[model samples]
Target chain A: MSRLSKKERQKLLKQVIKDNPFLTDKELADKFEVSIQTIRLDRLELGIPEVRERTKTVAQNAYARLRSVNEGEVIGELTKLKLDNYAESYLTTTREMALQKTPIIRGHHIFAQANSLAVAVIDAEKVVTGSAEIKFTRPVMVGDVIKARAEVKEIKGKKYFVEIKIYKDSDLVFYGDFTMFKLENGGV
Target chain B: MSRLSKKERQKLLKQVIKDNPFLTDKELADKFEVSIQTIRLDRLELGIPEVRERTKTVAQNAYARLRSVNEGEVIGELTKLKLDNYAESYLTTTREMALQKTPIIRGHHIFAQANSLAVAVIDAEKVVTGSAEIKFTRPVMVGDVIKARAEVKEIKGKKYFVEIKIYKDSDLVFYGDFTMFKLENGGV
Candidate 1:
């Protein structure tokens, strides 16, 4: 490892990070058998952001591409979205969402989260749901943290087909396929 | 008009009421140039129910064919439902449904009503929303009386495609296209 030149180590560092984006600077330093300062310098020279910044960039890019729904209108905290591509969100069910006499969250609450994500993924001036098919494999309960992922499957004219899956921990809880229609920005 | 026989008048009355179910007994009596009592007697002889009963029957038939959702679980007052055909529901937004600092009802409430109507129209032991495309054409305010209608547009195997429209005072306020999945009665 000591025989490796600075240029060679920087190249390897870049590849390792691309493979595993969560690694810390200290970990990279240890793997490269170099001092932490050297790793930091290499990262700065290569214009590579820190892990936190890297993660934030993905999320920011997603939000920036959103056009249909406002940030507050999104049912859950949208974690990431790429226009006409893929998106992610996180929702923690509240006590008020519980069904009568049960801890299970109301079905509509789940649908709202998934539906909003589908609309947000469309890169358009406005979007409409043309239709959807959905299923719930398990009940989500109050206080359960759910994660949702959406992917655009196809686009035909002004229509977009999106698929969304929601999970609680590792369990698949809900699924939805949305057909969205993109509308012109203004009537004029 | 007096020269017309009773049978001839009753036959015309039947056809007229069929064309316009909302006409009252008084209106019919005036139109037929007969007393209200005579129209009532004629309706009884013809096995035609009162207008209120006629409307109630349509609503009752709709609610009766519902198997996928319990009446209480429905988001709005399910007025009429015919399994695998068409259905109607009415929802009046309450004060609690109003958004913060605005009298407008939240978008999710409108979606809940449409989604529940979609699920309730499926004549299955159990039903799941496979996906939907939806739009809020106008903001629904608190105390707004909204009417929703759903029709089964198509079906393929275990899937049902439904179209739903909502109106507030004859203005189209919302729309949804839903794809629903029917699950078997028992996991056993």
Candidate 2:
């Protein structure tokens, strides 16, 4: 990072953020030993969007694929989906999610977010959950936002093992491991 | 029901609804071989609320337990909860849960409601999900109301296996088998 030429640095920057789109410009600058402005210029010159825009594009692309292929479901506000790889979504507990007249959100809702994110990450037109193991570490309340990220840990024939974790800000509130069945091509 | 006296019929009605709180008045009327009005009268005489109200009380009781016991979560509006036995909740898809700018509800929100109900049904000072296997059968639209019911199928030491299902009216939309961990008394 320190000794690369301008073109090489820009290429590496692209790869780094492409791999992990949540990195801030300031963080990139620190890693690259450059000013934030320099990082921004590199992003612009390379025709790359900011971290937020990058995620929006990934999520939007996944939606487009779902639309084109015909069937799939994604719950929560999908923020990013790289099918067959990983996906993430955001959900904020609303009053409707709380126990009637109470502010604490139901635990299943947290699992739902994680489980659905796991489902969304599958690279198939149709996927169904086969089973799950999950844990809730903390409680979520109405108006609190959670980001659920799911990654495909392994795929065996038609069976996909997905791992999901949810955070309220940086606080981990939920976790899930899902076994999903891809029902494409007669389940292969 | 025809052979029983009025008091006996009423007693059975109360117990039936207590065991399964979602039975509609019409269903009860059919089961009792009595008119809807007669079922209503029996409900009122027995001091048992209407099906909707009955669920509300059960759900509210669970919420109260959560508050006093200091942990546990319910994501969807809990409709009913019988700790160490069963619980159910309701959720409606909102625009926030859809893919960005799309009307399709994300898959995870469906799981969230069911998973939360599973968490709310445990009789414990603290509980966490251990794992789950889930399947999505149909797409959920914005404004669609889903009923998620979780039943404690078995318990082994501190681990509980809960089965959850989500229905849109009578249409089964999702299913999950969950492994949950109840963390009380050092996990017993």
Model 1, span A108-166: residue lDDT tens: 89988987898788887666666666777787878877889999999887878999999
On TM-score, the candidate that comes out on top is 2
> What are the per-residue Cα lDDT tens digits for candidate 2 across A1-188?
45789989998998877655666798789889999999999999998898778767765765764421232344466767677787777776798666553466666567666766776677765666666666667778798767888898999998998888888767888777788877664322
Error of 2 at A181 (Å): 5.2
> Please, what are the lDDT tens digits per residue for candidate 1 over residues B51-88?
88875665566667677765567787777777888878
> Mind sharing the TM-score for model 2?
0.57
lDDT of 2 by residue, B1-188 (tens): 46567878888888877756767799888888988999988887777788778767766765775521232345566766577787777776788777553466666667667766776777775565666667777778898767888898998989899898888767898888888776555322
Candidates' lDDT values, in order? 0.77, 0.72
Candidate 2 has an lDDT of 0.72
